[model samples]
Target: MIDLEEIRIVLVAPSHPGNIGAAARAMKTMGLSRLYLVSPESYPHAEATARASGADDVLARALVCQDLDEALRGVTLVLGTSARARSLEWPTIPPRQAAERINAESGGEAAIVFGRERSGLTNSELERCHYRVHIPANPEYSSLNLAAAVQLLCYELALAAEAGPVDDPTPAISEEDPREAYAEQIEVERFYVHLEAALAEIEFLDRENPRQLMRRLKRLFNRTRLLRTEVNLLRGILTAAQRQAKLARGG
Candidate 1:
C-alpha cells in the first residue's frame, strides 16, 4: 500500500486559531497526520485546542515555520488551493484529481498549501506551487471556510488512498511518478528571481510599471513541473539573453 503520510497539509498565515484546530480535525478524520503552519497569526489559543476536539495530538505535533519556504522544506511537489484565477492560465485540477496524483507519488514528500482565510493564496505564493486546485462550489457565493476546504481536500485524499492501485495510463506531467523529482519551491523561486532580473535587464520587463507579466510567465513555467536540469537549462538561457542585451547596449 502506498503510504499517505508523505503528504503534508500546510496552512499559511491562518488568522483564526479555530480554523487551525478544525483543519487538524479534518486531517485526522482523513488519515493524514502531517500538518505544517507558516506564520500563523495565532496559535496555542483556547479556540484552537477546543476545535481540534480529539485531534489535539495533531496540533501538538504540528510543525510551525517562519515562512512558506521553510514550511515547504524537503517537499518536492507543491499544490496551491486557490479559488480565483490569475491573469495566466495555471494547471488547475479538481480535488479528486489532486488526491489521485498525490496518492501516486507516495514515497516522496508533497504539500498541499492553503493561504489565509480572507484572501486565499496570493499571486506570489501561487507561483511557488506546481499546480492549483479549485473546488467547484456555488458561484454566487463560493466562499468556503478554511476548515471546510481542508476537510474537503482531506476527504478526497482519503478516498483516493483507499481505492487501491491507480491504473492511470496517461498521467500528466505534473502527476509524474514519485521517483522522478522536481525542483523544490525555494529553487523555483530562485529561478523566478533570476528570470525576472534577466527580463528587466533586456528591457522586456518594465522596472517601474511591471504589471502581471512576470506572474503570467511564472504560471507558464510552473505548469511544466521543471526538473533540476530543466531549471538549469532555463537559467542558462536567461544568462545568455542578458549577455546579448548588455552587448546590444555596449555596456
Candidate 2:
C-alpha cells in the first residue's frame, strides 16, 4: 500500500502565500498530506488560510524548513519538478512515470520538490535530486503556476495510488538487500563533505580552483542512487586515503 503520508510535497522558496495555500488544497483534494515548506517567502498569513478554503489543516500541519537539506533530512528518494531539460541531463521522466516510481518505493520517505514560481530550481538545488519530473505542457508557452504544477503531480500520485501498484517484471527489493534501506539525504550529504575533505587532503581537488569537479562527482553518485552500505564503504575508502596521505606528509 502506498502511504500518502510517506510522500512529502516539498515547496522550495515559494514566494506566494496563496500558491502555498492553493497547493495545500490541491493536495488535500487528492488525499495527499505531509507538505514541507522550505524557506517560504510568506506563510502563516491570512491569505494562505483564505486560499486554503477548508484545507487549512494541511497548512497548519506543514513543516517549515530552513532549506532543502533540512526538508529532505530523512528522505531517501527525491524528484524535483522541472519545466524543461538541462545540460546535465538528469534522469528525466514524465509525471506518470514519476508517480509510478514513487509508488514502487517499498519504504522510507520520498519527496517531490517544487521550486520557486519564477526561476524554478537552481542548478545546486536540482543536483540534490535523483530524478527530475518534467511535465510536458505546450512548448510554445510552458509556463505553469506553482499551485497548478503541484496539483498536476498530486493528481497523478492519487491516481496511481487508486489504481494500485503497477505490474512490473522486476524483482522487488528484499529486506536483506541494502536497497531496502537506501541512504537518507542527510547521510549522503555528510559523505559528500567527507569526500571533498579527503580530496583536498590528497591534493586531488585544488581548494582554490575547484570548479565543476564536485558537481560532476555529485551527478555521478546522484544518478547511481547509492545504497546505505555503499555510502559507508565509499566513506571508509576515503578515510583510508586521507590517512595514507597524512602518513606520506609525516603528519
TM-score each candidate: 0.88, 0.92
What is the per-residue lDDT of model 1 for residues 1-251, given as tens digits with 9 covering 90 to 100? 24667689999999999999999999999888899999989888899999999999999999999988898887767899999867776789999988887776633478999989989988778878878999999999989999999999999988988997575323334436433456677777889899999999999899797648887888777776667667878899999999999999998
List per-candidate RMSD values in Å: 3.0, 2.0
User: How much lDDT does each candidate structure score?
Assistant: 0.84, 0.88
213 in model 2: Cα distance from truth in Å?
Answer: 2.4
Give residue 135's lDDT in candidate 1 (0 to 100): 93
The per-residue C-alpha lDDT of model 1 at residue 150 equals 95
TM-score of 1: 0.88
Which lDDT value does model 1 have at 242? Answer: 95
Model 2 pairs whose backbones collide: none
Candidate 2 weakest lDDT stretch, 10 residues:
166-175
lDDT digits (tens) for residues 94-191 of candidate 2: 99998988887776789999999989998788888988999998989999999999999999999888888775322354657655577898898999
